[model samples]
Target: MATEREIFSNSGPLDLTAVDWTNSQHRRTVAASLVQGTYSMEHDRQQKLQGHLALGPPWWEFFNFQPVQVLVDEHDLSIFGAIFKFKFPPSYGNYLPQNPPQYVVAFRGTITKTDTKKQDLKLDFQFIRNRLHQSTRVHLAMQAVQNMVSIAGAANIWLAGHSLGSAIALVAGKNMVKMGCFIETYLFNPPFTSVPIERVKNEKLKHGIRFTTSVIKAGVAIALNSQHQRSQKDHSFNILSGWIPYLFVNPSDPICSEYIGYFEHREKMMEVGIGNIARLATQNSLGNLILGATGKDSEPPHLIPSAYLTINVSPTQDLKQAHGIQQWWKQNINCQFKLHQYR
Candidate 1:
């Protein structure tokens, strides 16, 4: 695992204006740096911004982006995210792609520090309960995203977050998609609220368990069909089928590894002539179904309809390294990628 110092340069000013955004490595490194900036702002806000007088400029500046606004948690007054605007215009040159993002909204994961731990963990708990969208932080994030989308078109904006922050971004991005807006998104080690069944070593046992679970979810969905029509959120998934967000996961990271099996198992179900059942099961979690039946609005945070899944196959020493946002910026790591589109 690379240290924070190794992953981020602190020696002197670095320039990335000429870097090719078309390259995946460049994009990943830049996105990770922006996310790291949120952490810096929360802990060491004053020093890092002091240009050459200090050790060096903040990491986001190294990539020719400036923080336009800092997203603060209303309850704790702690910074959790930032909106970055590229220094150059989209029409700058051919170096960047035609539809390069003019603005990026990057969010940091849980910060277990003395100052921010309580609020961060509270949001994490809300995530586990499928209630993150009801939190003030998430609502603020969604509002920030919406304002940015209105100013810069959705095609010119991007969303990136890690761990719990990724869950916030997912909810905001999903809402934007429901409104017929599709923004490019990047998620790193986003927590999936489910049994860590992806860690089961025995393939036969794993497949059997997942198959049974899918059948149960499908049966519940069927039972609820007559009593309750699909929620507006559920119906929006049909529109979300094509807006593919990029998910970065490590097999060793229990917090996010289930994404690998989530998509792969859906393919297996399709091959077995149970595609329709799995489709309904994948979108409607049992918790959401029960809550919806009780006239409560609930949506599963990790029930993404489609994504471009990137799995880090590299070895890690511990869970910290496995789930750390630093892993995404490392160069030459072994990674496997697949685009999972749900019909």
Candidate 2:
């Protein structure tokens, strides 16, 4: 962990792009509150089989993120696998009017269940195909965010989620983009949208670039960013409209590494010409024969968009705490933000 006065870096020589340190720290701090809400959901469940909480008073004091509110009210959100949702101040942009505070929404990841966590991951993949709303859990989250935005008339409604929650955030953010809503996302150890490549039944048939119709559009936007100042507004899908994403991941964590790193891998490959060739060659049915090939783990047509700062960490300092939010904070508390050459 790097101190406030120090720069955050990796053990290796990866030249990292930095983010706005104060704002980055604030997002992590907000993420911490949402993390606590997850634990409270679990304990409250054990006691009375409850599903949501208000997270007020003393707890919000610790983070000093005041005037907080939890949307969805007394209604239980567990059936949708959206265990918890919280409202806090946005890290970017200002409100149209000062009456309502500019706000952001954070979602709690899946609770232990075949239905909640596992199920949402399957639905998350459809995000690129333009099919995210098909999932009930995701649809519910989207509605909640939309409703919150409507009530607050939030100039910008930022979304953050962990694990499956992060995936939901990505999908919902995409939908928000389509609506031309102002938004930003922070994903904590977000999972990739596809299963392992080895698991594909007919590997030979599916080989080549995993570029989905939409994923290709996103890839091109990223390749351009590697060389120019194209903002999200310039991207075809509106992915680069204002700012790129703020991503936090453990490099070796299987959920994100073996699975989710696909989006990251695709960006790197395309920046080097794999995407261009994949786009050009595929025009020939036979040229498509060469197959651009998906990441060792990513899906083609990577639609989640780009990252302003992809903060890679090794918080598995204690193996037991590898994916734990506490570990994530313990590692990120001493944080820094900078501009590195785009990866």
Candidate 3:
């Protein structure tokens, strides 16, 4: 476990007096910090469950957020998420944006501690199996976000999570998008759950394999479409194409690095005069295609049509460091962001 200082040294205390809600950097740091606070909430719960005093102020204390609702897993009874209300001091007096979201629903990733490890690991497994949306945790998360959107309205609600929790956030946000409710979302180190071909040593071989795979997938989708009519979900995905969520990923994290390639490959396809093939390929995956053929409605959680993809280019020592949520708020990290809109 990292010390509090080690995790937050770069983030420091957020300056509420000067924070501009519209600024990208301010928004990313704040969202990442809130997710860290959700992580702290579970840690605080465990310490109290074992009858020990929790040390240090809440990680989100500097960000002026209060957890209004804590999401506990129904079956495992472990803390996994929270809904935080922003406290805008009156003294600040109209400095921030007039319509900034008042609440942020944030979720924390896998906690390996004895108390929460079982449930956290279970959710991680569900994520890898692409059954995370069917899990009780995701159901709870979706309901929580839905309730918040009802109360705060879509424009006044933000969603954020890390790792396994980010997958939860992604699915929930996708559901909301399907319902025509688009909430501002931030996902840090969200797992891609595909082959880690992004780590291949040969660039030419990597591009060759990906391009070939794209063409095959595209062909299969077209053949399947002719045999069976497209489902309503397939049509609804067009709406999803317009809702761009912010994705923060590290290039070295195998769990999320594929996203860097996912978007880049589409652009590469365009350059090679095969953009049409990638257009369909990028939308539907092999898993979803098989599911569709069998008449099961399956949407690939990681296959969003658009995103503000922020790639952390900083070198990391290992996958653990690269995948950790703390890296996002760290100072001096090199990050490059591009908007990938798949048409």
Candidate 4:
């Protein structure tokens, strides 16, 4: 185990493009980097559970199963993973708004049942929680970042994951905050749609907890909430709209479009007459299962057609029915918007 300074000196000038992140050298480099800051590693160790910090065969096995390559520099860290995007139209016109190109970090990982065939529901619950508890993906990520900082300097970091990777990224972001590291996270179609309000609040309280951004195009949020509503708080579980923005992009279908509109206006509509009546009526009839429930089982409201116009790329014939909205409202409402064709 080398100190951070030693590793930095030995590695020479850091070239993110040169490092084969999918190889074992990358892991070793990251591990060494993390151990460099005496205080940082100590802090991470203290915050992590006993078994949670172990970076042994079991931990390495997970990443080996699915390898994702990442590129990091002083300005940003970008991931190249199993995730890729293809647009409908061929070109993303120059007129579209664009955000600063942030570094993308990609991870290839899997989450699986540690145990199966347990008939006792209680036992199953414990098993599942324990499996989730022992995951070391984020810990490894933190280490890699430490290495990056050692070679380069402090940089804005963003984590992106598709499915299971998204959930892992969320967990990793929370763990990083506990370790006193701040990084922004972006998740696309994450498998778990909602998080416990208490957890959400605690994460929000962390000094470095910038935001947990999410993008889910369809009814995934509703379906996930419907299933896990019992464990979440309504108001506490609002979309990660604070510094982190959750964008919901919907294509034009009347019902889908209306649902989007309802999401965009539900909060304000709740303040008026007929809209309030309609909201309450829908809530009662559906067991308060629609988007705006404020209890454990409530769903975050969706952003519809009008909301889409506000956030989406300038409309084209191809975007006839699309709309979008952010989940939280605490951040400055400035996002560079762009349209890309994925076909």
lDDT of each: 0.82, 0.46, 0.81, 0.30
Candidate 3 — which pairs collide?
none
Q: Candidate 2 residues 1-343, lDDT tens each?
A: 1222111121211121222234555456455444444444433443453223322222233333343444331233443322232333354346322222245566656455533445444555554343445666666778777887787554545577777667777777766766767565666766643344423446444344344532554455444334333332334433433435666655445555433334444554567777554332222122121232221222222233445445445435643244544434443343334222222
Ranking under TM-score, best-scoring first?
A: 3, 1, 2, 4
| lDDT for 258 (candidate 1) | 91
Question: Candidate 1 on 294-337: residue-level lDDT in tens?
Answer: 87757788898899999999999999999988778777679998
TM-score of 2: 0.57
Model 1 lowest lDDT segment of ten:
48-57
TM-score of 3: 0.91
Best by lDDT: 1
Off by over 4 Å in 3: 5-17, 49-57, 94-99, 231-234, 293-297
Better of 3 and 4 by lDDT: 3
